[model samples]
Target: MASLSVGVACVLLVLCMVVPSLAAVYTVGDTSGWTTGIDYSTWTEGKTFKVGDTLVFKYPTFHTVDEVSSSDYSTCTVGNAIRSDNSGSTTVTLKAAGTHYFICGVVGHCGNGMKLAVKVESSSSTTATTTTTNPDFSYSSSNRSSFAAYFITWVALIVILVINVSLWQEF
Candidate 1:
């Protein structure tokens, strides 16, 4: 019985540590996706963004996701984008606790309202559950790998729990 209790406690401790680090993933622009003319400012409302969360921009080949400085974002300056990608799907991990700016680099896109600004709070400030902009969202490779690893960890934990239960019963 004592051994079973100790095993259960260890499993619970491991789960507690791992659960807090699991980051939430969001799809930019929600159901409409990343495109011009949609009001991005409204999309970020009611969402609590935190450091370690991910922002996935899903758009067409003709469009681009550009991370930019606050000044550049305000002016729609495509030339000075901090980071740019036109791969159709851009996965951005929020690494800091500050406002992050993004825009579409294509000519006139940002001016036409293809821009997003998200305020990321420190993880220590709050905890939010994993979420998505839409019900239908796909994971990138990094996300897939991370999920697989987490699945394996849970399976191992369950096996340990079962073994402990069996041992307890035998004793």
Candidate 2:
């Protein structure tokens, strides 16, 4: 039985090492880079942005990346930019679970609709949650389904192994 326990431990160790914590990297505007005449809203449609994911902006020297507030974004006001970058290539990570806005700082560029808005969700939100009106006790948060599956599987295997060992000893 010691060997069986060791084998189970080895399998668990391998699973822990193999299951990668993956994060997606999106190239903004696809092949067009972060420039004018690109429909950023359409590009991000049907896509779910999560924390840890990155947005890569590739543009020329004439254009600049400015992370601005929603009000500034709607009014094309780059003066209140939270973060500004002029490099040809820029990568911004979604560190928090909230909305992020980006726009070009060039005159009349943002007004010409050169902007992007992304809603970043928590990485732990793998399974979708549904709303419930039960006031007694409601579960509206994300359930750790992946971890629960792994734990249940491990417990079942251990139970099966224990039962098999008991039968073997009886013989």
Candidate 3:
């Protein structure tokens, strides 16, 4: 019984340490999905994106997710796109800490408000703050904890509580 308890504790400790480092997967535009006429700027509001995070763009075949330079994104141009995807679903992994711009490549779609600019921070960053920019609005928010971090904190607290309870019962 003691050996089993120790094994469980060891496994939980490893999971607690590993889970917080796991990346967050965000579905862009949420339930509405990636589409024109949606407020992409507001969608990014109050969200802090860290490196290693994943952004999944789900949209119809009619739309294309085109990654472009800051200048191209501002102008809604796609001929110089850094990356382009027209499939029904597109998954983008944030590899570094910087602002990434994406827009619909279809004519007038981007102009109709199908553009998103997400600012990513290094995972090691202490402060959580992100700024999402668009042609019409620029938003910056701070101090939000990642889901993984929060989940691990709760798990650790529960484990501590259980261990203390077990010890008290023994007394």
Candidate 4:
């Protein structure tokens, strides 16, 4: 009975520790034909995004999501870049707080105003709230945690079963 109690407590503790590191999914680009540029005209900017928020690009053409300076387009040559193809999706995790810029790397795309900007607010607060209500954008933080918990639970259950079977001389 004591061993069973310990096992239950261990399982609960593991689950508690693993539930919050999951990745959330967020959609970028416009679903409707109204927004013609790489900019997230269909989405909101300057929202609070946690560390695990995945920005999904749902555009119909190839585009690059690059972090750039807020005022100068010359600094656009720097920062991390993600190139997504048409009808394809790329999930990028927000690691820090700052304004992230995106543009179409295709020839003359950026020059033609195919650019978008996103301001990722700091995620230091434990209870940060987002200000956008766009249906195309969504976020979830339990993806990684849920997978980890499921994996751990299965492994533990298998190990426990094997041990019990061995003790009962059934193996």
Give the TM-score of each candidate. Answer: 0.77, 0.64, 0.73, 0.53
Residue 6's C-alpha lDDT in candidate 1? 86
lDDT at 43, model 3: 95
Among all candidates shown, the one with the greatest TM-score: 1
Would you list the C-alpha lDDT of every candidate in the order shown? 0.78, 0.74, 0.77, 0.52
Please state the error at residue 6 of candidate 1 in Å.
2.2
lDDT (Cα, tens digit) per residue for candidate 2, span 81-127: 77787877777777767778889999899998899988777779564
lDDT of 3 by residue, 23-109 (tens): 787889999999977999999999988877778888899998888888888988867877788887887777777788999999899
Model 1 misplaced stretches (Cα beyond 4 Å): 125-140, 144-149, 160-171
Q: How good is model 4 by TM-score?
A: 0.53
**Clashing residue pairs for model 4:** 24-140, 39-116
How far is each candidate from the true structure, as Cα RMSD in Å? 6.5, 11.4, 8.6, 8.0
- Model 4 residue 125 CA deviation (Å) reads 3.4
Superposed by TM-score, candidate 3 places the C-alpha of residue 124 at a distance from the truth, in angstroms, of 1.0
